[model samples]
Target: MTIGGHLEELYGLPAFTFPGPGETPRELPEPDAVAWRITADSYDAEEQWTEAFARFCSAVDTTRVRALAVGAWEDAYDRGPGDIIEALVTARDRLPGLRSLFLGDMHSEECEISWINQTDVTPLLSAYPALEEFGVRGGQGLRFPALRHDALRTLIVETGGLPVEVVRGIGASELPALENLDLWLGTSWYGADSEAADLEPVLSGARLPRLRYLALRNSEIQDEIAAAVASAPVVARLEVLDLSMGTLGDDGAAALLGGQPLTHLRKLDLHHNYLSEPLLRRLRETLGSAGVELDLDRDDADWDEDDDGTVHRYVAVGE
Candidate 1:
C-alpha cells in the first residue's frame, strides 16, 4: 500500500525476499513467477549483497526467472547501483526470461527514498531488450539515457523527488509498446526540478501510442501538471488517469473538468489531495454520472490551510 517501500507484488508475481545468512527461505509455489528480492543485512555491510546475488544465481535457474527486485545494497545511502547493474548485465545471457525489473526496493528502514543513490539505468533496458516492465524507486542520482525499448509495456518511477534529467530522459526516449507510465513527481525540496515544458513529448503522445494508464502522482505542482494534462493528447487515449497524492486543490480540479471530457476514461484517481467538499461533490456529480471510477480521497483537506491566511500544499513524500 505504500510507495517507495517494498512492493508486495509486481507484474502478477508475489514478492519473495531471498534468505540472508541465518534467515530461513520460505517455500515458493511458482518459483519462476516469483519476484525475487536480494539485499544486504545492514547498510554498512560490505560485499554482502553481491554475495547474496551470486548465491541466488547459483541456486535458482535464472533462465526461468521473470522478475527481479533489488533491495538495499551495502551502504545504499553512500554506494550506488552501478556494480549491481553490471552484475545483472553480466548475467543477461543466463536470464533469458527476465521481463520485469525493479531497482532500489529499499524502504525507510534501510534508506529514505530521497537518500537512496542511483545511476544511469539505460544499460538494463539496453541489455534486456525483451523486458516488458521496468521500475525503480528513489530519484537521487537516477539517470535514464536516451534509448528506445520496443517491448517495454510498463515503467514506474517512485521517488520522493524526481530529478529533471530523468523526467526529460523519459520524455525523449521512445517506448513504442509502453502501455503504463507511473511517475511519483515528488516535491522540489529534495530534487524535483521538472517543469511542465519538460513533459511535452510525453504529453504529446508522439512516441507512446499504446499508453493507456498514466499516473503523475505525489507532486507539489499537481495543479500545473493537471492543467498541462488537461490539454495533453495522451489523455484522450488513456483508459486511466491518476493524479493522486498531491497538492491538488479546486483550481486543478476545475481545470480538469473544464479542459477535457474525461467521461471516456475508465478511472480517475485523485486521492490524498486537498480539494474542498463542494469540489469533491461536483467531481462526483460530473464523473459519477458517466460511470467513470472517480477517487477523491482528501485526507489532507484540512491540513492545507495554515494558522495564518497562507496555505501549505505538499506532496505525500517529502523526505
Candidate 2:
C-alpha cells in the first residue's frame, strides 16, 4: 500500500460546515488550525514494522502534507535499532513537501540513534531536503550530520548527555541557512571546567549568519560567551532570543539584555534561570523603551495565563 492509501485508511475526509441563519457553529477552522499532528509507533503485531512504515509512507500524498511528526512509543525500545531507523528513513525519504519534522521521545540506551558517536543516523537527515523546521526532544547525546542543507531554516535539538563541544561543532558546520536555533545543553553545567571551555570556540566564531532566533536552554554558558553573543553583528538581525535555564545570574542577564543592538527583536525568553525581579524589570524596561516585544517566563501564576491566551503572542519567543 502507498502513503495515500494509508492516509485514507487512517483518516477520513474532514467535516465541514457552512453558516446558516439562526444556527450556532460549534467549531470553526481558525487561522491557528493549520497545525497537524501525527503519532506512529512500531507497526502491528502481525506485520513487519519496516514494511508497514514503507506502506504508510507510500500511501501519504507528500505534496499536501506540510508538517509531519515521527514519534516512537514505549514499544519502540523492544524493536531492533536498525528497524527503527529504516522506518524513519522511509518517511523522511517519501515526504518531499514536509516543512516540519518533529522527532520526539526516541529512547535508546546504547546511543545507537541519538548519540554523536553512533553516526548511523546521519543518512536519515538526507530525506528532509525541503524541511524548514526540525525538532528532536528527549534523546541522548544528540548529534548532526556533517552534510549541510540549504532548505533548513529552524533547528531545535534538546537532548541529555550531549557534550557542549559536540553541540557547538555541529552548529558551526551544519545549518548554514538556519534562521532559528534552539539548543539545550543537558549535561554541561557551569561548574564543569571541561564543558565550559569546549563551547568557547564556537561562540566566538561567525558561524550563524542568517540566524535570527536563538535559544540556549539548560546550558552552561558563562558571562563572556553571553557578552560575545550579544555583541555579535549577526545578533543585530535577531528577532527572538532565549537564554533560559543557564547559570546566567543577574549580572550575566543584565549584560546580555543591556547590550542587545537588535531593535527588531520581537520576543525574548528568559525562563527558569537566575533572573530576579529587578533584573526582569530592567529587561522589560529595555524592551519596552525600545519598542521591542518581550516574553519573560515568570514564576507568577499569571504568566501561564498570558502564555495560553494567544499563539505567537510574542513572535520571537516560545516553542
Candidate 3:
C-alpha cells in the first residue's frame, strides 16, 4: 500500500489521548497503549508547556508507547518547532518503544500545511534508531543529513516546495529496510529546484531494494517525471505507482500509457491532472482492463497564454 494508505489506517484507529491543560480528565487514558498524541498547543500559555509535558511523561509509561504524534507544538510563529524535538530528545530514554512518529499534524488554523517551517530532522533518526515509520509535513528549511538506518521501513516527506538537495540526500542515504517512500515535489515557485535527473538513483532502482510503493506527486514537471518513471527499472518491482496531484497533460499521460506494461502494477493514481476526456476514457479502458485501480479524478483547467502567447500549465499545490 502507499504511505497515504498507511496514514489513512493510522487515522482510522482509535487513539489514547494525553490530556491538555483545560480538558476535563487531566490524565493519560491508557499509558500502555500503542497510539498516542501530544498536542502542546492545548496548554494555556507557552510558560505552562514544560510542566504540562512533565505531567504527561509522568502519566504515561513512555517505554511501552509505540506510535507518538507531535502536533501544533509552538504555534507557527515559533522557531520552526525545534523545541518539540528537543523535548523528545531529552526524554528519549523514556520512549524506547517508539517506532512510528508523525510530526507536524497541525490543522490549517494552527498553521497552513505548507507554511509549517521545519529544520534539520537528522537528529531524530539518530536519537531513535529503531524508528520504522517517519512522516513529516512542510519543507521550508528542511534538511536530512547523511543517514544510515537499519529499521526504517516508511519515509514520507510532504511539502509545497521540496529542494533538489533533499531528494539527492534521500537517494544518498542507506536505508536497508525502506519499503515505502513518498515525496511531494511541489512547484518551482516555492523551492522545487530539482529536475527529473535528480531522481536517477531511485529511478534506476540502485538505492532501495525493498521499495514497493513510490509516490512522486504534486509536481510541476510531471511530464518529465512520468517519462523517466515509465522507462525506469524500478517500475518492474513497484506495486503502486502514484503520479497524482500534478500538471500531467496529454503528452505525459501518453508517455505513461505507451512506455510500460501496466499489467504488473496493482494500482495507478493520476488524479488531479490535465488529461482530456478522450485520453481519460482510453486510460480507463486500458488500465482498467489490466485490473489496475485507476484514480483520474480532476480534469485540468483550460490553459492560458501569456502576452507572448506562450502556454503555461500548473500543479495542484505549491503556494
For each candidate in turn, the TM-score is 0.95, 0.65, 0.89
Q: Which pairs in model 2 have colliding backbones?
A: 2-58, 2-59, 3-58, 3-59, 3-60, 4-59, 4-60
Error of 1 at 186 (Å): 0.6
Ranking of predictions according to TM-score:
1, 3, 2
Give the distance in Å from residue 133's predicted Cα in candidate 1 to where it truly belongs: 0.6
List, residue by residue over 183-296, the lDDT tens digit for candidate 1. 999989989999878888999999999999999989888999999999999999999999998889889998999987999999999998888888888899999888999988
How far does residue 269 in candidate 2 sit from its true spot (Å)? 1.6
* Model 2 RMSD, rounded to 1 decimal: 11.1
Cα lDDT tens digits for candidate 3, 146-228 = 58988999999888789888999898888889899999998788788899999998887777889999999988899999988
Give a tens-digit lDDT track for model 2, residues 1-319.
0011111110123212222222454453431223333334333334343444454344445456665444443334343335555666665645555576655433343122323121234455576677777766543323453567777887776544444444655655656688887776643321112344455433444666687787765544534446666766656677787776544557677778767565677876666555678987887777767887766664421112345584111111112
Return the lDDT, model 1, position 202: 92
Model 3 alpha-carbon drift over 4 Å, by segment = 1-13, 32-34, 42-52, 299-312
Q: Against the true structure, whose lDDT is highest?
A: 1
Best by TM-score: 1
Candidate 2 ranges with C-alpha deviation above 4 Å: 1-52, 73-82, 90-93, 105-120, 188-205, 220-225, 257-264, 300-319
Residue 180 C-alpha lDDT in model 1: 96
> Which stretches in model 1 have alpha-carbon errors above 4 Å?
1-5, 24-30, 300-307
